[model samples]
Each structure stands twice: as structure tokens, then as C-alpha cells.
Target: MRLCVPRAGDPATATAPVAVEVAAHLLGLVGDPATATVAWDIDWQGPLSVPLTDEHAVQAACGIMHVHGRAAGRPAPLAVDYASTVAGVLAAQGVCAALLARAGGADVTRVRTSVGQAALLALAQYLAAATADGDDPEGCPPSRADAGQELVPAACSFVSADGVCFELEALDAERWLDFWRLLGVDRADTGRGWRSFQQRFATATCALPPVLSATVRRASFTAVRSAADRAGATVLPVRQDPLPPTVTPPWTLTPFPEPGGTTIDRDGTAAAPLEGLRVVESARRVQGPLAGHVLRLLGADVVRIEPPGGDPMRGVPPMAGTTSARFSALNAGKAVTEIDFTTDAGRRAVRDLVSEADVFLHNWAPGKAVRLGLDADDLRAARPGLVYAWASGWGDALGPEPPVGTDYLVQAHSGLAAAVRPADEPPAPSLMTLTDVLGGLVCAQGVLAALLTRLHTGRGARVDSSLFSAAVLVPRGPGRPAATGRPLHTRDGYIALGPRARQRPERLAPALGLAASASADAIASRARTRPTAHWLPRLAAAGVAVTPVCTSLADLARDPRFAPALTVGEYAAPLAPWEFS
Candidate 1:
């Protein structure tokens, strides 16, 4: 792919990841490079361009087509102010991309539509804010402009007319086009005479001409609008809810001085941002363990305290020589020890660990945690400065919902399963453990944020996260149910439709499907004819919903974008040991 290197004095100068402190913030739905698929397998170890694989290109193309389709619905000489419209679109796309990346979608069509709608929503909110703010709101704060600027509280909000709302003023079209180019969207119109000439010869996949992608997206939305108008329907505009205010942070951040006693190893890693901080991990399974992993990533020394039987996730599928890849993905790169917190001795061990620990992460049942003396009060009584992190299946600790949860169980419980299946077919839980991974990522962010808070305040606080809550948080959906019910699928279900409308019910049915009927069976039969790879692109063209079935962990490993998970279970150490100092 081609790249359009910014001029020497460009505002978004590339910097080390730590320089961009909230690098993870830039990575998700909130940032400009609003992406759909994360290219999870991409070698995240190095720079952006060298690893420009096919998956990255496909993902980028998908995002461009989606934006274009949305723009096609709009009228030409679009009344949208250039900067504001594009900014709105970028904001929406950022959230959509983050969702899509965190939870892989079923079909390409939904991916595109969801992304476009999300982009529109984000854009709408931004413009509404800008219009409310009387036009220019300090011309898009520097942090919003730069990919590398540290994203602290001061940088999170823009000065709005009413007060300080956590929204930005909108951007006009020309500036929007520039933003698109910076994000690597492809387009034919560069608008600048010789400037167009300059980027014409560049690689199409590397970096899109900002103006080009914007124009293309505008055209696509115009077409979509025209089609709707011809069908005798007025297009309804999309809107988004206000983002949650940063409250009750999960963890705190503490910048560390260079190590004086320990030997330094800075060859390829980011600076040890939390070199002297200590994190005590009591979490089992992915969500809580992953929080500790994130702390370790930022240079904190993480001490993982596993129960005697080890984490239950160790028994999860896709194991290698009896070890679970699922467990390894979240638990690697930390020092591990075994403890039994249920016993007084075990509780004492935990207290000793917490006395020197800056953060503590766990996923035990909430009430059980308190009964077992692992509650915030019990632990804090021993160590006041400790940041307690708790991840669970549901949201019982605070607002709505109760404990008793699992990743897949939560997917079925939280209406995520409802969203994934085809409208006509039996509900099928997602092939991937979305709640597990998404919750893990969020828990990690919470832990880090809480850490940052500890840096400012001498006191520590309890930070709680859960799969039930996170599932609701990450996926755009409705509020909690007054009373909970049993999860839908204790077993797997299927979704399929034959090429013809009248396929036999017997042929379409899964060998032993859950909640399958004759009608559902017919749908499944038709579904089988169109393998995931073939159906994804076709459904996108037809505007139908679909979900690609990933049969095995190996299938995912085969995809280059998923390489990080491949060596997850290979935890053996080198034969010869080396010294740190």
C-alpha cells in the first residue's frame, strides 16, 4: 500500500507509544483511524506500514465502502459544513470500528451498515455540540488532532457553550477529506490539482488521499439516499447517546523514575512507565487476568495469585498438549504464584501481597468475595493504598443484574446472541467469547485509569468490572432488565438458509440443534450452501444479515491477523537462564 508522509511540520508528528500515553484510546472506536476489523493478527510489535498485509487492506476497504454508502444517501452540494460533517463521520466511525474490532461481526453487510450508522451518530453529536457551541470550539483541541498527545482529563473535554461537555466541535468537508486521507481511506478525487498528481502514483492500500475517501463516502451516501427516495421512504437520521462521564475510575496510573537497582532492558519496549508500581492479581479467567497483563505491559510488576486448582479457564478448549490457549492469552508475561484465599492462611498471604501491591484484580462472585474475606473492605483494612479490581459475569455489585455468569453464558444472557443470529433462524451464540475478551480489555483500561488516579491521589479505591456489564457497555444496546432470566443456550445453535426457498426441513436441520424447528431447519440447510467466505461478500451486496462461523481456534490461528494467539500456549522458558541485573 502507498503512504502519504506528512510534511515535516505536520501537527500529528509520530511519537513513541508512551508519548501518546493513552495509545489504547487512539486504538478503539473513539479515535480518527476509525476501523472496523482490528487486523488482530497484525504484528503489533513494530511500525504501522511494514506489515501492510491483505487483511488490513480488506478491513480498510470495508470501512471505506461503508462510509461511502452512507454518504451516497445525501444530496450533492451537501449542506453539511465541511469540517463539521467529516468530524461527525469520523467520530461515529471510531466507535463503530472499536465495536467491530472487539467483537467480530457475522456478515460484511452489517459490519458496513453498523459502522456507517455509528459514524453518523458520532458525527451528529459532534455537530450538534459545535452548533450549540457557536461554531469554533478552540479549533479541535491539540490532543484530538495529534495521535501521540497524552490524553489526560484536561485533554478529554472541549469547551462547549453550555458548559464543559465531553464532545468536540464539528469539521467542514475539506478538513474532513484531509482527516480521511490521514486515516488511509481510498478515493479518486484529491481536489488539489498538483496535489492530486503527487498522490496519484502512491500505493492505494497504504494511505488514502483524505479528500478522495471523503468524496467517495459522500457519493456513496448520496446513492443510498437516492435509492431510499425512489422506494418512497424518507431517510431517518441517526443519533447517539452521550458518552459516559469518566467516573469511579478502575485503576490509577503512576509514572516511574528510571530503575536504579534493577538492570535495564529498553531495547524494544516502551519506557517503564510504572516501573516501581506493584499489582496483585486475584482474577481467574480472561477478564481479570487480562487487566494484570495490561499493567505488566505498562511496566508494572504483576504478581498473579492463582487458586490451588489453577484458573478454571485452564480447562477451556483449544488446548495444546493439555494447556489452554485461552488461558495463556491473558496470563502471559507475569510472575505466577498459587494461593488459597478461602482459608485464613491464604487470606494472610493475599494481605501480604496487597500490602506492597498497587492494584488487585479478581473475578470471584461479589457476595462470595466479601464472605471469603476477599472483599474491598477486608483487603483494604490490611492495605489501604491497594486498588481493588473485580470482574464478574453480571453487574450485581452496583446497578441491576446479579452474579452467576460465564463469557458465553453472558453473550446469551445480554441479548448479544439475539443480535448475532439471523432474524429468521434460531439464536446462535457468537463463535468467539466476545464478553470475555471485551470485558478483559475494558478491565485492563479500568485498572490503568485507576492507577493514573492513584498517582494524583494518595488514597486508593475499589474498581469493579463484569462481563454482563461490559457486554452491555461495549455493544450499543438498551438498559438492564428489571429481573434476570436463565441464559438461552446451554448448548450451541445454528443459522443457515438454502439457495432456494423450498428446501426440505430435514436437510436444513442441524444434526442435534438447540431450539430448532422445521422452519429453522430449512434456514440452516440453505445457510450451509453458502460457506462463510462466499456468503460474506454476497450478503454485503444484497444487504442481508449473516454471521461467519469460525469452527476452530486453529481456523483463527491460520488467519495471519490472529498470530498473537498462536503462541499463547507455548509458555516454556529458555534452557539457559540469564540475569536481569
Candidate 2:
């Protein structure tokens, strides 16, 4: 099996240069770089690097805030190239997994993923439900707040008197009273309900850091963190320094020499490398389900087992009638089975499923696997050659793990929140669940490598990835150049201009009826004089990267390049990024 990709300099292609570089890195992992090929598509450009055809348009119109409830019209701070890089990484992982299967004697040929899919995948957790409609009425809370923003009463950063910042999350409704008691707030002054209490707290903390700072100043950071942990709350010191780039590779492959368990033969199987493979996915939330989703796209048979009430996400917001658009999007290509894990029968059924599966994946809280008898050793005992993958908040190497490892918490601990914050503002996490998405991709990569090893040694291996580790792997540096082409207002709508225009200022000047030496402000002023219709064709003819800002998925659906990617029926959906040739 040979992996062929377009070369970086292919004259006819506009694939992202970064995407090509990432693809090369993945191919290097397989130890056979000579077999890969690269081609160029003339229509491709940097903007095309984003998987979705018109994502920039969407962000521009929506204002892309990380925390909900901000005024919609506020323009987002200058954007960075997050979605494309993540898309590149995930695409590489999918291809590598398929190639591994082929190396293990499966007759697989190709694998693919798009930048749009990567962007959606990263936001899976947040997008699974609508803001006001689902099981969680409050919607996804802000992971952290900017200095002057309204802090989420339950989960936010509070500074100590010593000027040290600590993140605290105590979101359980039933525990509000308990939390008040723990904080030594008098019960007599406690408000009537959760809402009232929230209001009171909000009023008291109107001064931002000073209010929370004064409250926690009575105790040391260590004491506060310890108490928060003891009360089933999550607390961590806010890491201020940017984390150095990952010193260790994102995925690790280990080979076992011992012979054991059942072996799968790929002979006469369908062309997809994983066509005959069976996967038992006992995971919930973004990380595990996403890993399963990727494998399913590559033609593996994935059975997602949920507890009796179904995965909690089934009831998340932004529903399309009775179905959760978020849940359906991530889980569209797989089979689902509900088993009551609390019963002995359910446990046995899961064990039986594992015995026949090529992979077993889960992201249960730490120690829960051991309690449920679903640890790597127990599952491997049932199917000696089974690939077991564990996704968590933090890996075992981070001794004495915290009680919680959600994506937001991991962001705070891993320095991601601080890195993205403007120098003058309080820390704000990425608007998307960046860590969860990356962790899922890394999990798939590890499982694929283990599968390859299993084919050779007939012994399975354990693969681990954590949100913390994934966050660490994301590259951070000086921000990319701002979209020099600003969005220009016209009679009808706004049009994106700049990037391509910057490259050919001579051509852009004539299209916008401006002098070649015109400043950006001058060009913008000129563009506003005409309606979008008058300028779109003229600018486009000159090869300026321009398009109307898309306000919704429907807007993107109208584009020929994006129409095929839309999954329309009872509910509208975006198809997974990858495609097999």
C-alpha cells in the first residue's frame, strides 16, 4: 500500500502548505516515505486550507466568541489558523491508520479528511446542543473569563491576595448550599434558589478579580485548592507561562513479542483496510466517540455501547426534532446498543463484545475502569489480541491525578487559556473544545499503530492519550498575519477582501478603484461606496480571495464546493471530513 499526496509546489493545487507538511510527518511515522506522492490543484489557496468552503465567512458574521452571551456584533479578535492545522493533523492520523491496516495485510488504498470537518470535530462538545434548548439550560459555560466579563458564578478563576490565580469549578446544583457552607457564607443571607444565589454572587463579584480575590485571600492557594478538591469541586493553579512545545511525540507504538489471542485475516476482505474489523466503543463525550467515528469512516464496524438511558449527549441541545444534531453528527456511521452497566448481565454482554472486537475504547473517569472491571488487563484477558485505548484528562505520568479532566479544566492546567488570552485581558479558553478533538485524533493514531503491531506479534497493546497532553501538542507562536483583506460593507452585504489582494495590490487597486499606494483604510472606504454585486465579480476577476460572509450553515450549503458535503434529510449535517478513494 502506497500513500500518495500532492507535492507542496504542485502548480495546479491550492492545498495548504501546512497540510502537506503534516502529511509528510505522518508518512514518516510509517517508515516508508518513498511511496507517498503529492499533486497540485490550481483552484486551491490558503483559505481553502480550512476544510469547510466558507468557514471564514461564518466566523466573520458570528463574531466567534469563546464564551456565550457576548453581543453578537462584536468582531472576534484577529483569527488564527487553528481549524486548518487540526484538520491537517486529523487527516494525517486517518491516513496513517488506514496505511497501518494495509501493512498488516489489509488491502486498503486511500484515506482523507477536510479542514471543515476538523473544525466541527473540535467544537463537537459545544455544538452537540443548542444554547437554550437542551438538557443543559445554561448551555456550555465559559471555561474562563476575560478580565471584565461576567464570570460564570460556578466555575471561574479567582485570584488570591498574593496575586496568584486559581481556577475553580463547582457546578453541581445540589451542592450550592454545601459550597456556601464550605465558603463560610452565612446561611441566613443565602438566596432562595440557584438563580437568586447566582444573582447575589454576581452582584458581589461585579468588580471582577478584586471581589473573588478578596474572598479567597483569607487562605493560601494550596489551602483553597485542597478544600475545593475535598468538596468534590475542581481547582487548579492557573498556569501563567506558555508551555514549551511537546518534547515527546503525540503517539507511541510499542511491540509485544509474546504470542496470544485470536488473529484476524485480511484476505478476501473488502478493499477498505478495516472493512472486516470490529470495534467495541464503550466511550462517551467527544474524545472516545470521535475516535470511533474516524475508524468507522475508514470502514471498520463500530458498535457504540451506551448505558440504559443512552449516552447523555442524546438529550443535548440544538436538536433537529427528536434527534441531537451534535450526537448524530459525531455518531452517524456506527451502530448503537444500550446496556445497563449496573447489572451483571450488562457487564457480561460488554465483555462478550470485547472478546470479538479488534479495538475497545473508553474515556471513563480515572479509576472507574478498574471499578467496573473494564481495565486494559481485564479486557485483554477476554480477547488477548484486542487493542485497548484509553482517553482521559491527564495520563498516569502526572502523578496523583485531579478528580476531573474536562477539556476546559485541562486548558487551564496546560497553559492553553493563558496563551490565547490577549496581554491586556483575563485568560479565555479556546472557543472550541480544541483539546478534546486533538486527543481523539491522537487516540486513533495510537490505536492504529497498536493494530499494526498486533498483526505482526499477535499481541495487543495499550494506547493512551489525555486532554492535557493533547493541549500541550498544539503549536503556539506569534499570531499569523491578520487577514489584511478586511471585510468591506456594500449596499447588500459584506465581502471578504485582503489576503489575495495583499499579494497583488496592483490588481486590487484597480478593482477597488483606489490608488496602488492606498492604505487599508482608504481601500475599505472605497469598497463601501458600491454594493457587493458591483464589486464581487470585479475583485474575483483580479484573483482576490473574496466571498460574502456566511451567516449560517445554510449559506455554506449554497456553494457548489460545499453542497456535496452537506448531509440533508430530517436534520442537516456536515459529512465527516475524510473520504476514501
Candidate 3:
């Protein structure tokens, strides 16, 4: 979003006309939230990447740049206006919750959201790990080898001998070793590489042996595919052709009729939109659990069902008071109960919990639920009016036999990896778990919409959302020609120039003591002659919007702009990405 500059003289506002116009655009209404009715059963298509005034500011302050830049091995922001997209989805969530509240007999009126808070929510896990005590204090990227200036550490997305840049995924360690060994990698290197390769999903840093890339570079994509297939791994080429932009909602809410279903009745206004609602989440990883987390943020009493001894992610790394900070970031406020869902007893236990819950959500593999006799149908039968949400990875788009169906691989398949980088750059997926976070929000959106629909029809819904589906919501348009608003290198530090400053570089040229050639390079060159502090005031005085690039996660805590959205504790966490009035 740093690159998206609103035209000069165009105003930026988040509420009233802008908000009302967006609301109107969504519901075909000329009114505000107060009069919004569940009768419309409003289904959101999507908004174009908004030219938010705080886009880059939020990115810089919230450590999003640090995450993305580190992954790219450069100081970079997402090519897509990701924060604004998240903000838009979050806005839809708030509205849906409000609709649910009104339908529940509460006089709900207004809800609030911001790009800043959405930014925090996007990187909430990463920030938590940074703040949490961990063995790997210095997270990879900005690769420390080159003072963090080198290309991605020779792992992750790789180019085939035929020039096809592709992502390879292997969840099983033996499969990863099998694939690599097929390419004639030494037993020593493959063994070492697997250690970091397995940790990539958790740590977001895959510092593997360069021989892996060298091996892939020498092999044709056909060879690579053959090796993967033989070894039980998945390989997907990063698509250059963009997926057709999504014009429909990211989730599906299919309602089931209930002859004697009951509508919820509330006496007075509650603390939040999802107050009194009970959500039973039996989900693993980011997409499903993060959805539950967002529901928890909206005031749902979320009860997380885990296997006996709890989800193993609790011991992954980066501990915050003995729990995985990343895990706790998504699940901190939820109540948990252990159920060995692999067993008949455990499946029955889960069903019992679902019987008393308003919603039962999960992201189990394709037939795992059915194998256990606990698919959405089973749960909803146990609780007739239950909102059964399946936070899927493939969303039935890939037929019965789907590919890896995880975040990074989905980015490669969905064209997002190609979309997030410039045409000239390699198609590298950001290690920041973008798809998972967005998918989570998409699932939460479906759940809320289903709940709202239930208030009117008194029928529960089957809400399904997927990482692949969520990927399309972020449009792959021709973005800004140059990222002029990204952080520029100053003598002592980096600072970001905002829309006003970037759109009119000539206006900023004089501020930096440069002549008519106020190109991005010129500004950056001159910036390096002085410290970031030296130019910040000068740029501001010259009416060029400027803010420091918060390159460190710890720095964000001290940033006043970031303080409002965060809760400082054993690990840093973001507050609910909304405001209500």
C-alpha cells in the first residue's frame, strides 16, 4: 500500500460519506448502518485497494515491512494494498456482527475499524514471537549475512532448470528428504536442509543449503515434478497469469431449514457484537484458529477443542510464559478443552460440546471429519441450529484430491505470489502467512453472516471458506509504476514518504536540497547524506508526509501511532481490530 498514492487534492476519510458510500455500494442502500437490515442478507463482493492515508505508516509502524522486506531480502512492502484489504474485510465483519446484534433484539448501532488495527492483526503472530523470549532472537531475512540486504536465503521459492519459478511444499520430513535426494543432494546437505525447511512454516525463515537451489536450477520442471510426485511432495509453478479477480464474497453461507428453530432474544445492549455467542473451534494453524481469534475479539465466548495434552504448537518456539507466543496470540483469550478427536470417544466428546455451542468451526483435512463421523452435517445434526463453519484450505475447488493446500503453496497457485512482487522480481511468496490470516478473516466473515441470517430465518448455516478463495479477494491490478513511498535509506536509518510526498516528488526535491531531478533515487541518495531525523522535520516542514520505518519489532511498542492497537504483555498482542460506539 506504500506505493498507492491518492491523487493530489483528493481527500481521505474513513467514515460518513466514504463509509456510507462503501456501505451503500455493498448493500445497494443509500443509508447508514442504523437502518441496515439482515433482510438484505448483504453479501460483500469486495472493495478496490483503498488509497488509505495511513497505509505505509501502518505498514512501517506495525512491522509489516520488516516482515515482508525480510522475506524478499530487501526493504519492501506488499505490492498489493494488503492492509487496506484486511481493513475492508474487518469492516465487513463488524457490520455483520452489528446485524447479528440487531437481529438478537439488541439496539446495536455503530462499529469501527481501521487500517492501522488491521495491519497489526495481519502481523500479530510475528510481533508476538519477536516480543517473546526465544532461542532464535534474530529472526531470519534482511538476511544477516549481507547485513540483511541479500536476496531471500536461497530457499523457499526456487527456479527450475527451465526457468519456471515454483514453490515446493513437503509437510512430512521424509517426503522432503525423499524429494531432495532425488535431485542427488548429499545426504548431509538434505539432512541439514530439512531442519530449517520444516521450521519455515513456524519461524518464517527457511535458511536452507544453497545446494538445494543449485540442484533445482539444474533440473527441468518436469524432473522436479517427477521427483516431487515420487516422493509424496507438492510442487506448483508460480503463475504469471492472474486469477480473475473475485467479484463474489470470499465465503459461502448455505442455510438449512429448521421448522421450529428459535431466534435469539437479548434484553439489552451487550458489551460487543458477538456477546453471548459460543464458538467451539477445533482448528489447527493460522486460518482456522485465527478465525476463532477474530470471533473472540468480537466478544464471542470461544471454547477451543484440542487433542489430549493440547495442540503441539504450544511448544513450537518463541515462548511467552511457557506457551507458544504465536499460538497464544491467536488463542490467548479462548477457553480450551482437550478431546482426542482421533478416537470415537473423542469424536463423541466434540459432538457433545457442539450440541451446546452456537458455532462449530474446523479446518480438518478433506475426509478426516467424515472418517470420524464429525463433518458439518454430523455436528449440525447434534445441534440443529448450529453454525457449522469449515475453514478449508482448498474449499472444494481442487476436487477430491487437492494439492498441499497450505498458505505458501496456495499463494503460488492463486497467483498471489506473482502479484505480490514486481514483474521483474522473482515470484517469491511472503513468509508472513498472508493467506492464512486473510483466510481466517474470511471464515470469520462467513460465520458472522450465517449467524445474522439465522436471526431472521432461524436456520443454521454451513459456512465454508478457503485460503485459495481468500487469495483472489486481493486484486492483481497494475499497481503503482514505482514504489516511491517505500522507506528510503537515510544516513542513520530508513524513513517512509507518504502519498503526498511521493506523488509530487518535485515538491520534496527542494526539501532534500536537490534540484528538479527529485526522482526516488535522488531523494534516497540525498537522504543517505543525513540521518533520518535530519530529514524528517525538513520533509514535514516542506509538507511532505514522512515517518520512520520501524525496522525493529520492539520499536513499534514505543511508536505512539502503534500504541493504540497493541496490548503490551509477556508478548506483544493487538487489541481487537475495531472500535465500537
Candidate 4:
């Protein structure tokens, strides 16, 4: 692949290639970079510019630091690279899809993605849901008042008596009672439902953690893990290690006669390659939904299959009316249906759906799909040429049969927590769900590749992505130097100064009223002498990449250009990072 490096002095130009590199690595084409090319000179900031006030910048920076609630007072840098990286991956996927389609006899060329677009997609669910104005507001859960309560009660970190921190995730509602029983909690006596259990533990303050920690300390990690497995719960010990990102070729390819279904029609429009493709999604949470969302943006007809009551995420916080802004952001532009897959009729209905689908995607824990008679083999049997995909938290090689794959647990296992930890501080997670977002991107990439291969071989393939692998793919190393340019405090707000400022201190110092010989701390002190408005123009005139940090999605939506990206119907949603031409 030939890289079109942006002109010197533009940091934003470097973002698009991150996705290409990732895709090339996955395709085993990194060694032959000349095979692909990028148009990197695209003006990214023009469509994404938003006004940034110093006060808003500081508040946004603080919002990122306090994402975990537990780290509210801590000084932590936002993982600013995440948005661009994810956008790059999405861009790469689009390119790959277009290339494959062209090779498969479709007329198409030139796929593009931007950091701004990627940032929007990465936070789509949150952004859409938060800005949505619904008539009937969903009631907040009782646990909402508790600062420590996570959305899923069972999927949080717990400390052991020995102070070892681990994560537990019991996603299967049926296994809820069993999990508590294994933890030695008797539901018969306590009469606690899942929500109540989460509420009690989350709000227990000093009471719950100690009891659980003491109890967990009595057993070895292996023993606890084994017990969890027997109870159908996923438990994993948090570790501090580096996990480099890597991708293997597709794992399973089964040849069978084509189902003779109609291929997705392009309608003579080369702009959307995957248009007319029908996707049946039986996935929950961010990973599968995000993947489906990407496919939808590529012009697929995505039909999401939710359980009888609807997706659990529909009830997650920051709701509008009866709708979850998070849910709307992820499921927008797709058809949705409620299905009770546990029933015989539900199974048959899904089987019929699969027969007509080009893709069948899910994130059901291992064995759950099989138990429900909806495993890859079953679905592929229904549609012989179906591109079957599964997203999980861990790869199959992990010792535990099915490890807990929640965002936090995957972050811990994949070494992200260790890598991003500030000196002398415990491991800190990125403010966003990095692994899930990346995993979704990887999953989409794999699915697109599988589709391309199917065009050639006339057969279906199984594509898999896990949070562990996604975590590994993230580039990690020593953080930027403390003295390196960073978000600087202004008398009334904050502004991000790029490292270019540090490299050109002669030009930057005067802009901030600092001497060229000033120390990093001295520069920051000088910056605080003026308000943001006074310095923003000077920094821009000097050709430094600077902006007021966005305090919230709402803040970003206020800008007209950004408003279009975030607004969807009555709700604000993230814009897809890629534009097909």
C-alpha cells in the first residue's frame, strides 16, 4: 500500500494510515505495502470543526478522566488516539470491501474515512441516546443513585482478600441465580432479583467488597475460575502485561452448495458496495451492534433480532422516553424485531431468517448458540453461503472454556490497563470502551473479507473477533513525555497544544507569554495568565493544531458542522466515519 502522508506539520493527516496498517496486518499484506494506496490529503477538519471554549475544554478533559467515577479526582490524559484509530480501521474496512467488490466484478473505487468520522462512530450510541428527546422518559434504575454501580451489576471488578482484582460477568440471565449460589449467596433467603443484587452490592460501600473479597480469598484464582465455569459464569483475574495486537487468517471455511439466494443489488449505484445485502443480527451490547451498524452504513439491510423484552441495553442509563439513546444510536437505520429464541417457534423463525440472510452475526457466549440450535453450523446449514461471524471478549485459546469478555475484563487481560496506567497509580482504563469498539471494527473487517472470498469460492466462511485481540491491536508504549505539549490551562479555560508547539518553542512561547527557555510547568503557568480566546487565535496563526477540548457531546453538537454529524431524528447520533464515492 502506498501511503499518502499528509503535508508536514499536520498531525491529523497521520490518522488515516493507522487503519490501513491494521487491515494490512490482518490480511498479511503488511510486508507488501505497495499493494494498497490511500488518499490522505482529504480535508478532515473542514467538516468537523467545532468551537472550543477554554472552560469547555477543561470540563471535557475532566469528563474523560472521571469516566470510571472512581478516578474523578485523578489527573489522567484522555486516550485521544482512540477515535482516529477506530476511524482508520473503519476506513480500512470500507476500502477492503470496495476493493473486494471491484475484484468480484462490481464497479467501485475510492473509499475514505476521517478521524472526525471515526470519533463520531466510536461514541455513536452514547451521543445519540444522550441527545434524544423522547416523550416518555424511562425510569432510572434504583442503583443509578449509587456512584459505584455499573450498568451491569455482575460485570464489575471485585477485590480478593489478597488484594487481587478480578472481573466477573454473568451475561446469561438464566445463570444469575446459579452465580450467586456459587458465590454462597442464597436467593431463597434474600429474595433478591438480579437488579436488587447489583444494587445492594454496588451501594454496600465498605460492606460488600470486604465480604466478597474475604470469601474470594478463601479460594485460589484457579479454584474460583473453575467454580464460575461450573456455574456458567465468566470470571477472569486482572493482570499487568503487554499484549501486542495480531490477527490470524479466517479460522473455519466450509464449502457447500450456494443457497441460490439473490445477491445484494447495487442498483447501479457504485457508491455503496454492500447495498442490498441483508444482515440478520442476533447480537447484544456494543460489539455486534456496532458491527451491524458499520455494515448498514455500507448499504446493507440490517435486521436486528432482540429478545422478547428487547435488548438489555435498551434499559441502560441516560434514556429518553421509553427509548435508550444508546440503543437508538446503535440500532438506528436497521429493522428490529423481538424474538424469544428460547422457544421452538422462535428458533424456526430465526432459521427461516437465516435462510435468506447474507450474514448471521451474534456474540452469544460459547455453547449458548449451540444449545439454542443457532450455532454457526446450524445457521450455515440454513443458508449454505452465509458469512457467519461471532464477537467475543477472548479468543478460543484462553485456558478458561469461556472467559469473561466484558470491556473492563478484556482491558485488564489485554494489558491495556497496565499500558495506560499513570506512574505510581493503579492501572486505569480508557475513558471509552476501546476493546469493544476495536473488536467490532475487526469483526466487520473479517466479515467483509469473508464476503469477498465467498464471491470467489462460492462458499461461506466463519469470521471471529475478540476483545482480547482488539486490545492487542492497539499500539501501546510509553506515553507522551510530561514536558511534551499537552492540554494547557488558561486563566478561564483549557486548550490543547500539540507537540509541534514544543518543537517550535520560539514561536509558541510568545503566543503563551512564556520565554523560549521556559520549563513545561512554567509554560503552563504562563498560559494561565490569559483567557482561551486571547491565545486560540495566536496558536492558529502560528499553524499549531489547537482546539478547546469538548466538555460533552452536547457541546460538540452546538457547532453547525458538528450538529449535522450528531443529529439523527429527535436524537443526536454519531456520524459514520467513512464516505463512499
- In terms of TM-score, the best-performing candidate is 3
Which residue window of length 10 is worst by lDDT in model 2?
200-209
lDDT of each: 0.38, 0.58, 0.73, 0.60
Model 1 TM-score relative to the real fold: 0.43
Write one digit per residue (lDDT tens) for candidate 1, span 302-341. 9988879877656543343454543554565678889887
Residue 496 lDDT (model 1)? 25
lDDT of 2 at 10: 56
| Model 3 regions more than 4 Å off | 1-52, 136-156, 244-248, 265-269, 478-485, 518-522
After best superposition, candidate 1 residue 41: deviation in angstroms? 18
Per-residue lDDT of candidate 3, residues 354-407 (tens digit):
888899999988888888898877888889889999988888777787986899
lDDT of 2: 0.58
Give the runs in model 1 whose Cα sits over 4 Å from its true position. 1-272, 312-322, 397-403, 426-428, 475-581
lDDT of 3 at 441: 88
Kindly list the per-residue Cα lDDT of model 4 for residues 1-581, writing each as its tens digit.
44445567664443344445554565552122322643322224325554322211322332332222222322234433454456556656766666544543576545555555665666665455436663222112343334353333222355555566676666654565575567676554222345443322111111122345456777667667776788787766665444433433323334445543334455654556676688999887788888898898777889999988888777764565576677766777789888898799999999999898889988888778889999888888888789888887776647557556677667777667666554444553543566777788778877877776676567887777777767777666654213333457788766665546646766677666566677777877888888888888888886765656544455555557675555556666666556555
Worst 10 residues of 1 by lDDT: 572-581
Top-lDDT candidate index: 3
Give residue 22's lDDT in candidate 3 (0 to 100). Answer: 34
lDDT of 2 by residue, 271-344 (tens): 55567778899887678888898788666899999888788777654575675666776787688899987788
Error at 274, model 3, angstroms: 1.4
Q: Report the error of model 4 at residue 438, Å.
A: 1.3
RMSD to the hidden true structure, all candidates: 24.8, 6.5, 5.4, 6.0
